[model samples]
Target chain A: MSAKIRLYVEHPLGAGQSVPLDRDQAHYLFGVMRQTVGAQLLLFNGEDGEWRAEVAEASKRSGVLICQEQTRPLVLPPDLWLLFAPIKKVRTDFIVEKAAEMGAARILPVQTEFTNSDRIRQDRLQAHAVEAAEQCGGTYVPEVADLQKLSRLLDHWPEERQLMFCDEAEVGSALALASETAAQAPWAIVIGPEGGFSEAERKRLHALPQSHVVSLGPRILRADTAAVAALTVWQQRYGDWG
Target chain B: MSAKIRLYVEHPLGAGQSVPLDRDQAHYLFGVMRQTVGAQLLLFNGEDGEWRAEVAEASKRSGVLICQEQTRPLVLPPDLWLLFAPIKKVRTDFIVEKAAEMGAARILPVQTEFTNSDRIRQDRLQAHAVEAAEQCGGTYVPEVADLQKLSRLLDHWPEERQLMFCDEAEVGSALALASETAAQAPWAIVIGPEGGFSEAERKRLHALPQSHVVSLGPRILRADTAAVAALTVWQQRYGDWG
Candidate 1:
């Protein structure tokens, strides 16, 4: 059987390359997973593709793995970004994990006017993205941007990327992606906070030329649910799901 | 502003009708939520539509609510069922909650050949469904069926209900719902366990005339993510999302 354990490392990965493991990684591979010398595993970095590596040296605090061969080439996801207001801790982690598994190229947490949580642990969220990528068998991991204000984000928004604004109040516009906007690359999906967007924020979003205001459905979905639904909808219509 | 709290109760709801809250409900409304006499809230039973209610009598252990008027008529979801193999505890609960929020008419836990968890707490999952419905502002709560063997479920499968079988192995057949089957009511989506379906199980599923084998995407998603993604896709094409 192929390697069941997939690890995300920061070192370069190629045939004949040796990777050194940190203390945490050593304990995880040796003590927790019960791996020894010559055990096979898959390794991947953001820049490199997946590689088949075997334990060359094993110890309690540190170890080394030598890459044997390239198992899979680097496969980048579609140029799609997910921007959502961070909710509770667990739900925020869920969103990041789901975003990585669903092939999001980037994840941005924006602080809105009614956002419940003002600050977010970007490092923690980034670690979640890495774990998700590892567990989901993804070759590339999405970058998690630090939390920023929604107004500033909109002001400095990339002009080329279209925004799929999920308007919870606009139940009538039922996600008619075929007619609303042409399915294309370089897209972002924006989900609001629990209390939803202020009237001014909605008006500003509506006035943006790059925004395609749409609704998930008739029901009032929670912010987390909205994120997943919006990602699924966007991926199906515009991304690489098809 | 309208009532911010939506609750699911077992009692009948109607104009001027008085309903008694159980101990847990009384504790939640009166003690936890700090709601007193004259406070208004929205209530829904499985059979009745959502009704606006006023607190007639309030105490720490008991309370009474008088219905004011129907706020939302019963908006039943399309005839869709979600069949999934139970994974970890938190993920299983996540599946039930998402099923309720995403418009599944029923949720079934099936024990497949590769299923790790053979038994599930039906009552706990059902409670989660109710909570999800209450939080999502859904007037209808879907039923959560007890765990059963996959073979038994297939033996008595409904002929009219088409099955959207999500085969993780078939990465080639992208989810082409439009071409595979005509979008209609009375459909079900089946997601396998983390280990995926056994070969025999896959063969049987493929042999079934009602099964439409499809893939979520190129990346392998966890069971919970697959459930949500499959529901979103099926709802967008076959259910009431349009």
Candidate 2:
């Protein structure tokens, strides 16, 4: 952890290997961040663990970094997915960023019957996830899946993965579903859009054999806040936070 | 629960009573949110429970609502406070807004050694708190205190109140502080600024008799995310969410 500046790179990292930086990475390191030849930093490639690398060559639009040693092993997030309908642009970004920071392994933007937006900019949202991981000192970045219809996703739902269906209408279930899941099982947390789930959608979710409708709490949370809050509680109850 | 719109008002609410709105409130209700005469909504005054109300009159700069009846009794939040060093403008607002939505009883902005912002707009932050409560259908609005010195606040800290000190440096304390606090005792979650706590400040917090240093998780989080995560975990472990 000698390198205070950590960057996520796509190249394979190993000792005595030279990693080439793309134009954007070169400009970010040399021009924007003021990194230079001989400067040290940490790099992670999602496959390899984090590595300590030193600038071997610096240029305006190209650079090279020589991996010195491994800094940290890759720490994968929990076997969890965040499934939600995209809301407003900014809040949707916030949900993805917070989900990345709060230990979600995958981010899924679901399209429900009442979901307002017809489509989402998948590339933009994925970039936000990457940026969140970079800023939050995370070694692993969650994949941001392209938007999918909730109905289709439910039709192909993995029976092995427990679904923590967060519903405001089921507020007083007496027993929180957080307690029922086995600690190591694959799981996903589903949150609706601002308009919430339609009657048919709610009924379909309630009838799922693997779905566990969990209440977030007594208070009504906006869709974005509910996503972060759900991740936090789940991490506290059974994720890596414990 | 029948009312679609929720607004926070300062006037007393009861059956057949009129509640007047200020210019901003009127503009929001009449112009932005488009509530016209005879339109029904929900109102809460912090002092009273939520009440169903109907628009009695609509105007350019002022309006009135007559309370129909009480819809919900006051549900007091757990005696929890969120204390954190103010960061950048948008994030500070986000922290206050989420704290209000996540069941924090009070919000305190404390000056610390590593705090970058010299001062905060208390009124603006408080407005954000109110907005969050209104949007989340919260019956109670947490008071946002003006910025105060951490040392002075600690000096006057109540003995009965327990502090959950979120420290990245103390990441391996397997037992979460949430389990240590009594269910109904006054509690506060302290999050450091973006630059994190100075060594001396961290030492002082660790030495405090009332403070229990706890780790958020293996991964590092931004200051705003940490505040929300802390509140969420607290609510899940011991607060009203249970």
iRMSD per prediction, in order? 1.5, 1.9
Q: Which runs of model 1 end up more than 4 angstroms from their true locations?
A: A176-182, B177-182
Worst 10 residues of 2 chain B by lDDT: B174-183
Per-residue C-alpha lDDT of model 1 across residues A31-138, encoded as one tens digit per residue:
999999989999999778999999999999999999999999999999999999999898999999999999999999999999878789999999999999999999
Q: Which DockQ values do the candidates obtain, in the order shown?
A: 0.70, 0.66
As a whole number from 0 to 100, the lDDT of residue B103 in candidate 2 is 91
- DockQ class, candidate 2: medium
For candidate 2, state the interface root-mean-square deviation in angstroms to 1 decimal. Answer: 1.9
Error of 1 at B231 (Å): 0.8
Interface RMSD of 1: 1.5
Candidate 1 residue-pair clash tally: 0
Residue A95's lDDT within candidate 2 is 93
User: Model 2, residue A47: what's the lDDT?
Assistant: 77
What's chain A's TM-score in each predicted model?
0.95, 0.95
Per-residue CA lDDT of candidate 1, range B1-242, in tens? 24989999998888899999989999999888899899999999977899999999998889999999999899999999999999999999998998898999999999999888878999999999999999888999999999999999999998878889999888857665554434653789999999989999999999987888888888998898898888888877777777
Model no. 1, DockQ: 0.70
RMSD of each: 1.8, 2.1
Residues A1-242 of candidate 2 have per-residue lDDT tens digits of: 23777888888889998999999999989999898889999888877888889999999999999999997888999989999999989899999999999889999999999988888999999889988888787889899999999999999999788888888898755334443444568989999888889999999999988777778788888887888877876777678876
